[model samples]
Structure formats: structure tokens, C-alpha cells
Target: MDPQTDSQAADGGRVLIDHAHEGHFGARLRAAREARGYTIEACGQALRLPVRLIRQLEAGEYGGIDYQVYLSGYLTKYGRHVGVDEEAIQAELARLAPRQRQPDLVVTGGVSHSRYLLERYVTAATYVVLTAIIVVPMVWLGVRGTLDRDMPRLAPLDASPVAQQDAPATSSTSAAAVASATQPQAATPAETRPEDQQPVLASMAMFPPLDHSAARTPLATSAAAPAAAATGQGGHELTLNLPSASWVEVTDATGQRLEYGILPAGTQKSYHSDSTLDVRIGNAGGAQATLDGQAVQLDGFRRANVARFRVDIRDGKAAPVSY
Candidate 1:
């Protein structure tokens, strides 16, 4: 038998093998998609399907997918987009169908062995576009603000320090006479204390009672509002607190990536952002967030589930915003 004809089919219920076509039927569909000027990413975007799924359908690699019904839909969409008639592809998939029995209704599975689609979303091109849209205004404000703060102020030319330093070095005689006049006269013997009679105070008398309030630092940082609330005139303060392990990524409205790492238990970090704060958590149940000081509720979020939130920071700490 030809090697291609003897090729193996996926084990899962996801795909059916059509030994009759020799598994090379994908060649035509691949050519058609390319002819339409759609790359894998563009095709996935336009079809609202994942790239891995498309690749699998093309290569007949369905061992990773868990759902048969979804595969049917993929086949349907793939045929429609590439001008493959429904009848022909259906016959092929039908010949490749799982043996023994089939379900009346197929439900999409929650997980997949293939993680390509997950990684795809992580590096989506949309993120770059979104970052550009958010950063332009922040860059303008930051530059303008820096210039205003650093601009030099001019002083009168006549008041230059050079003029003061050049004042004819006063005659030495006059300077000595002025110094003598400003100095204290030597004390007479009667007016001076004896060498052994220096004034002294008991240890208790040395220091007055301490006033705790008076010694506080004038520039110390303090909470701006009640612990449960925070106010922002231009933006918001974002904080992420992890009571358990979680992977997180954060980007400020200015498109600056603040952090992206796996946070261990008991880890907490804070940031201030203008406009929006973009966050991604690999384990939503293990992560908690706050806007300003107001707590964000993540009660419904599940473990091992990824969640993305885009918070628009506005004036004041409004109700916890989520995407």
C-alpha cells in the first residue's frame, strides 16, 4: 500500500479518516485559502476559528481535539470558505467518523491537548494596536509635563553674582576693622565662670518631655482616603494581590509593560496608571485585584482558568471595573 494511503488517523472523536481519498485532500483547500490572500492568522480571524484547528483539519491531526460536533462545524466553515462543496467534504468526514456510535448533540469541551490557540491569543496583533491607541496621549502629556517642570527661569543680568564678587576687594584695613567691630570683646575674669564651674544639668533635666506628635515627619506618605475607597483626579491606582500562585501580566495605559511573571503565594504589587490597566491572570481563583484601595471581587472566577481584564481608570475610584 502507498505510505500516504496507510497513514494513521487521530484517536479522538474529533476527526474521521477517509482512506478512500488517501488523506491528501487538504492540498486543494490549502491552495484555495492561499489564493484568497489569507494567511493562517488572517484565516482564523476571519473564520472565528483557531489556527491550530485549521492546521489540524488541513493535516488531519485531530487527536488533540475533544469534541466531534465542533469538528463538524470546523469542516463546514472550512468547506464554505475554500469553495469545497458541502457534499464532498461531508462524505469525506463521514468516511473518517468515529466507529461504533455517535452522539445526537455534541458539546464543546473545556480543555484541549493542543495549547497553540492559547499562546496565539497571548501574542495577538490586536494588543499592539490597542497599546498604540492608548500610549499616544500619555506620551504627549508626559513630555509636556516634563518640559514645564525642567524649563529654566531667567534672572536679571544686573543681579548676576559676578557683579557681587567683583566689588573692589574691600581694603584689608577696612575688612579687618569691620571683623573686629563684629567680634565679642574678651570677658573679664569676674564675668567669666571658673574652669571647674561649667553649667550642667541632671540627665532628667537635659531633655524636656517628648511630644510624639511634634516629631512626625512633615513629608510622610499617608493614605489618601478611607481604606475602602480611593480618589483619583486623572487616573487610578491598580494593585494585584495573590494569596496563591498565579501568572500575571500588566500593561499601563501608556503601553509600558509593568510586569509579567508568576507570582507566588502572599505576593502583592501596586501600580498607578492613566486611562486603562490591562491585566491577565493564568489562575483567576488565586488572584485578587484592587482599584485604588477598593477591593475587586473575583468570587466567580475558577481555578486553572485564564481571565483578562481591561480596566479604564477614570477620575475617582468608581465601582470595581472589569472587562
Candidate 2:
């Protein structure tokens, strides 16, 4: 019999062969090979097959060959040429192969092309579903881990030193001397003594009480009002009275700027608030103001809103301020 006539027909009881699909597969294989600019001989070299065998396979007339085995290798080789998934193409070929009582005598009417079409579709959908199932959870886990890692640490606030304004100053120097003392010296490390050593107090000095005749006034007593609650947030505003130009920045509770600008001399800048403020009176030549009417004693650090002694910023430097 002529090899062409022996092949299954597209219709009738010849066999359940899909001529159109077979042709499409052949066209794709041919296009894939040619797209790489490879001739049939070059393709055969890659597959370790003769050029005649490759040409017969592309013509869809390799009846003498094991169609399943031959197509599997052919699809794999062609796939590499075009970067398509070889397994997916092999699966398509397996689904298209005729199934029957005997491979040689496949009965056409008993097979359903529609069933194979559905099977191919289901296989593709399963791959898509499996990919989504695997990838989505990984993405969610990455985001959740980032959020867990980024949460801010607040433990330091509870451990900070407290600043109590009502506490008496440790030094008895005049307020003028205190104001002039711009920097507080850090206390020397405490000297360790023997267990039997007794502590000693330093010598004391006293000044006579000021004469009240010049400023004598009737002693009036009024009950003090209850203290205001702390806002638990600290920030400051500065108004600069400069002879020339001066710029200053006031930071908020978190040491971030709440306001910043420039002003001229004798400009009564009022920065009055019941909050912890970070003031930077920058580039001013010998300037001063009444911080709540008591001279602006540019001394010791102020703590942050959350802590007692952590100053966020100072006159010209940054320090932790605590309340």
C-alpha cells in the first residue's frame, strides 16, 4: 500500500485522526525549527536522526515508526528551538494519540475528539491553579514577616530619667550664675570605699536673709490649683529677636520639625506652650529672652515627651530631653 493512502482519513471509519490538528502541530514544529534559522539537516543533527527521518516526521507520514516515542523526541527537540515547554507539548501529543483495542487498528467512531480537547484544557488549568496556590501564600508570608520586623521598639521610654521642675536646684548659686553656666559638668565617677568607711559631709556656708523693709508686703495666701496633666508629647517653638537675620527650627515630640523660620532683632517672638519643645536658636550673636519670664537659662538638657532626661535637641547640639 502507498504510505500516504494507508494513513487515517479526516472523516469516515478510517480512524479518529485529527488531520487539522496534526497539520497544526507539524506547522508549529516547522516554524520553531525555521525560526532558529536551522535547516532540516541541522535539526536532524541535534536529534541524532537522519535528515530523511526528520522530513518524514514533519510530513506526518512516519507510519512505520513508533508514533508516540518518535513524537515525544521530536516535540522535545522542537521545544528547545522556540523555548516552549516540551512537557506541555508531549502531553498534547499523548492526548491526541488514538486509544483502542489495538494500536494498529484504532476504531474512529468510538473515540471522541471533544473528550481529548477537554482533557488538554483541564491539564492546562491544573498547572495554572497549582502555580497560583503555591505563589500566593509565599507573597503573603513575606509581607507579614516584614510587618513583624518593622514594628517600632518603645522599651527605652520606660527606662528614661525623669525631670521634675519643682525639685530644688543642687547648687545654691544665684540665678544669674546658673544662667551663665551654659554647660553642666558631668558628675565624677563615685569613689568606692571600704565597707567600714563612714560618709562625711562637706562644710556649709549661710548668707544672711535679705532685709524686707524695702520690699515688705502683706503675706497673702491662696490655695494652689491642681497641676495640669502632662500631654505626654514634647515640642518647642522659638521666636528670635535678632539684630540682623536669624533662622531657628522647633521640633516636635519625635524630634521632627513642627515649625522653622527666620526673624529680625527686637522682634518679640513668643513661643509659649505647656509642651516639651526642641529649640535651635541658631547663628544669633549674644541674644537672650525670657523663657516664661525667667531669663532663658540656656542650660542642662531637656528630655523627650516620653522620657524624663532624654533631650532630643539643644541650643546648638542634639541631646536627649526627658520630662
Task: Candidate 1: list runs displaced more than 4 Å.
Answer: 1-235, 300-304, 318-320
CA lDDT, candidate 2, residue 233? 38
lDDT of 1 by residue, 216-242 (tens): 111011111112222223456777776
Task: Report how far residue 162 has shifted in candidate 2, in Å.
Answer: 99
For model 1, what is the error of residue 120's alpha carbon versus the real structure, in angstroms, after optimal superposition? 52
- CA lDDT, every prediction? 0.56, 0.45
Best by TM-score: 1
For model 1, give the RMSD to the true fold: 35.8
Candidate 1 is scored at a TM of 0.26
